[model samples]
Target: MKAALSSVPEKQQQDSEFLREVLEGLGGKRKTLPCKYLYDEVGSRLFEDICEVGDYYLTRTEASIFANNLRDIASEIGRDALLIEPGAGNCEKVEALLAVLESPRGYYPIDISPEILLDAERRIKANLPEMQVWSEVGDFTQPGVWDRLSMIPSRKRVVFFPGSTIGNFEPEKAEELLEMFAANLGTGDGLLIGTDLVKDSVRLERAYHDSEHVTEKFNKNLLSRINSELGADFDLSLFAHRAFYHQLRKRVEMHLVSLKKHSVSIADTRVDFSEGETIHTENSHKYSVSDFNQLLARGGFRPICHWKDSADSYAIHYAQAI
Candidate 1:
């Protein structure tokens, strides 16, 4: 059952917000779209496919690290702590952690995609029948999402932010985001976060632009999402997916390039494209252990300990709200 908390219907309000952001982003000097929208139902499934691609190793590497050190990690988190996962798609990563946790108090998963979040809620109910789950459907970054979390009872609150989702934000924004996470927690509350380590450009490039073309589909899916959700006529065929590592920026930049000059209509708005012009889609920042630790500190968390994969391509840190 859908219930509205305000005069505006939830779905209609969301559509309005999406259309406004789309127009503002496309109207910018550098045409762009927020990466968060990339995970609309279809994009989320494609991302799952991207993770299975051999070229994209972040997922498997993190899992291996967890498989190796889950007990130690859980020991650090200790017992009776509530696990709150933002962007908790399918909530797969937490199943193992929850299994090992010593009498975990409960789980609160916040996600923008209702389909994935609901499916995860059902899975957790069946697999961990004793564990409590309170799932929220909305953007995890929104303050209201975290605010809603305050109502769930727990002995201690720990934010489980796996998958290097932190790297999606710009450095400044990342610091602010961590601070926001900190704002939602008390001192001694925990945070288990992931970060992608800096690697050779060859490896980073391959990760985003896989040979199997799944990443290509993932990138272009943003355009497809805009076309579908906002009534935009984005010609998916006219835009080519391009991804590469920027040496100086220490990040992978993904964009959609226009094959030819064209105009597209979105709702009642018309957006024009120049030949070869591109819409910057997303950035995945790479960080060294030291750099990310500093970032964690700035975000109001004192760095505790971290675990890394065998290849050192990824690192997951355990920090505390300070």
Candidate 2:
């Protein structure tokens, strides 16, 4: 496989240090966990399995929208544009774009997973031989992560952020992220973003808490990561996976709830939790079309087009940097 530029060990060290600080601070109160820790190689594989589960309709729905609208999306963006995908996990949705977009000048997949990003780049190059493939390994939220991206030699840049990854951030943080993306582009540059729509509670809850138990494994894998990385003795079996739709918040919160009163030691650190105490793992906030438009406006973008499935359960919006 082609190797993308590796993320420096210093960056990995900084990430670990940040995790330590967040854990220490949260340990003092109710324990909390950052969602980023959920994606080690194994965790990433489990998440992909979760996406395929029957109850997990988000991925299939989004893929369907991409498949149906690929030509229109490509035509709208014009030819020979630089297709840059942020948080591009596995590049599954991107393949749809590549299949339809005519002769893209370059394909840049920006992601934190160096291994996955490299493998994805290799696959894209093999399939789309005419397209130059570049990969960036860094946290998408960092300020200067895309500075090198600006140096890529393409006149038209089209940012593709699929799979409703934006839902991972709070509204304000999402707006900030969009603004950062807008700043990365010139006036006529385009953004194609996928967003999960506000849907019924039953369907939303099932999507997170899948019947196959894959999502559960994915959620609990974070503790396993802590055990491996920080020399922690975490009884992963003692934590039950919990995911539910919060009606008021309009989001699905994933948690790892203690099955019984338990004490765990991580290196020199020890923490105790009563039965049923949970570590807040992740929140995926759903949105409406108007809500999404407001977010885009806040980020200095003007919506050019929006497409949705027949049920209107999800949307793919194309916006232009204003």
Top candidate by TM-score: 1
Model 1 RMSD to the real structure?
1.8
The list of candidate 2 runs beyond 4 A from truth reads 1-12
Q: lDDT tens digits, residues 38-132, model 2?
A: 87678878988988899999889998887788789889888878988887878877886877777777777777778777677778878877767
The alpha-carbon deviation from the true structure for residue 186 of candidate 1, after best TM-score superposition, in angstroms, is: 0.8
TM match of model 2 to true structure:
0.94
| Worst 10-residue lDDT window, candidate 1 | 1-10
Q: What TM-scores do the predictions have? A: 0.97, 0.94
Q: For candidate 2, which ten residues in a row score worst on lDDT?
A: 1-10
Those runs of model 1 whose alpha carbons end farther than 4 Å from true positions after fitting are 1-8
What digit string (tens of lDDT, one per residue) describes model 1 on residues 1-322? Answer: 1212334487789889888888999999999989998998899889999999999999989999999999999999999999999998889999999989999999988888778887887888899999988877788888887776667777889999999899899999999999999999989999999899999999989999999999999999888888877778888999999999998988999999999999999998899999999999899999999999999999999999999987889999999999
